[model samples]
Target: MTAEIVRTIPGAQKRTNDPEGMRKKVLDVAEASFQEKGYHGSSLGDLMAAAGVSGGALHHHFPTKKALGLAVIDERVAEAVAKTWIGPVLAAASARDGVRLVFEAAADELEKQGFVRGCPLNNLAHELSLADPDFRAALARIFRAWREAIAEKVRADQQNGGEKGIDPERFAALVIATYSGAMSMAKTAQEATVLRQCLAALPVSGQPAA
Candidate 1:
């Protein structure tokens, strides 16, 4: 069909030469699929359909399913962790306050959604870590970055005379562990109560004013 004829066809899309736009569109669909159904569970044909891309277009950006999965982890999941956890902690008055606020916000968001899908990173880690070495490394890096961001916040809070006598790195790990477990429990229960309970029992202490 001619270009003009293609444009006039109902329900037909006009192809663009915008590679970056296409890549981002695929990434958005792939990330959501990976988060909802898992990497192993989201098949390529289904992904292509959901992404509104042909096999050639999908492979042009990601040569394999593993490549797509890695991109989702390195790009999409990392961005989410940065926005949801890291940014809030760094901007909060103290590490304790930062973590508390994150928990509260997460609980509220999950309740509103009404279905607990669990943490994207946590969900992917459990499913992919044991299945592939590259996947493990990609996921490990995100977890490390997340842990370090929290640890850095804790260190800053301590220097300001809060979170006294606590090991920043260890405390950071504890915070992640608590959230991971709470999210898992909440996913199973299909509720956010475990998250609220865990948040209430968070160990780190902050300034009274905070």
Candidate 2:
């Protein structure tokens, strides 16, 4: 089932008997479990229990754990990147400000949530990159897409003579790497200060007044 289908169904929890509902519920719970605990650390039994679905139900939909993980990556995780990063960056008035705003909003969220967990993509990348090629490829695609989104904005900024000094590709790579590292540090320390410090150090020039 598509993430769009999962999202459109109201009262999903109350419709467990329906095939689509069961599938959506399983994906929802599995994504949360995988995010909280590493993929290998999260077992099918735990997922079934958390999702309030029987083993038969889960098997009927996913058939195997790997299939479920891939679905979460392709659907939920991809959708998250689109909603949180790509869409906002595309819509903002200035690409540089768009990138900064994303980090600033992330810092605020980290502070509000007490910085318990790091970025979902970063967490999965660390855990699964060496374990499975499929997982690694899926994650790499997301990372490339994210970097390209930012790079496109940087290129636009450069063309407009806003961010003229740096190479757009290099700058985009730096932004993603720095943000990921800062999130890891924040997760380790259980503090948001690391993110704020990183954001503060970001280069900005010719930025229009907000």
Candidate 3:
């Protein structure tokens, strides 16, 4: 009977009595709002309306706007980074190739979207990193994980007789910084040219010396 109930309403995540479900719904709405409008730009009312929950329901899950924003950063933003960057980078042939593929994919995605909304982690970091200590810490942790993942791949390539003498940590940082700045530029230009140009500039194409 219980399994049938779940099967019938597989999409029923907004059920009022399900606190966990309700929390997830609110977080999803808040994450999108933050990505689209920024932290300060998105009001609690806006989140509630978009989430289709009462003010009390929203408050019960998130007592304040900051709490909601932090949750988005910790959960939604972190998951996105893992999916969009970390996993793909690790799964690629080499760190260099992985980095190139990431840039190419990002450019393609922005083109498909027809407008750049910028990277989610980058967007929130710019708006909230300095606004609060907790925000900075959370964003910094994600950045570290991202960089380390790249560095890990780089080290793997080094072991396999590629990327000789390259400092994995520094190389990883450069890859991240380059893409981040390029994305910011792309957002401003409302096009993917900067992203493509940045990708071209990266030394991700050559083979290591024997």
Candidate 4:
């Protein structure tokens, strides 16, 4: 289920009244509203209403619906974006552990957010990718970052005694693609189990040569 709306926490900024904080609040509301109602379907009034802001406030922050959507994508990239592979990849003392931990952590994060498997990058890409070149490029950057971050972690593992004599890059791709597919399924089913199963299916690496 989508999270229940509450007063903006203002953690990202000093005050709820701050311009940046208020802008983020607008994006947060827009994301939920967009998820409920697609970009083409959702009216500016809907986002404004969800944010509990006047047209003046929304315009002051985002002058147009496309601008608001862009802000939403930016916020997703900076925070609350669901490529959880980063944390576990860094946590691993070993390469094999890094692979498992990264995928599993991804699953755990998805479940924690409850039923929403909304990856902001994927959400916008699936919708506006063909229509808007700018939107497509913005989301593509995040997607690239997500993959590169995992790839870097695996590369780091090689020097750190993470695993001995294995193809770290290929393994990174497997883990990333695995989690991405799992997240997509979870998004479709609206269930966390899909993610849990995907991670669980990952082969435990670092095994003795068979």
CA lDDT, every model vs. true structure: 0.89, 0.83, 0.89, 0.69
Number of colliding residue pairs in each model: 0, 0, 0, 1
Cα deviation of 32 in candidate 2 (Å)? 0.9
lDDT of 1 by residue, 54-152 (tens): 999899889988899899999999999999999999999988888989999999999999999999999999999999999999999999999999999
lDDT of 2: 0.83
Give me the runs in candidate 1 sitting further than 4 Å from their true place. 1-20, 204-210
Candidate no. 2 TM-score: 0.86
Q: Across residues 1-210, which tens digit of lDDT does each residue of candidate 4 receive?
A: 798887776554465567566676777777877765667778988777887888998898787788887777777653544445466556667556766676566567767777664665566678888989988887777777666766676677667665555566666677667766776788888877876565556666433332
Identify the superior model by TM-score, candidate 2 or candidate 3.
3
Model 3 RMSD in Å is 5.3
Residue 200 lDDT, candidate 3, scale 0-100: 78
Between prediction 2 and prediction 4, which has the larger lDDT?
Answer: 2
lDDT of 3: 0.89
Off by over 4 Å in 2: 1-20, 205-210
Over all chains combined, what TM-score does candidate 4 have? 0.74
The local lDDT score (0 to 100) that residue 108 gets in candidate 1 is 99
Please list all clashing residue pairs in model 4, or write none if there are none.
Answer: 95-162
Clashing pairs in 3: none
| TM-scores of all predicted structures | 0.88, 0.86, 0.88, 0.74
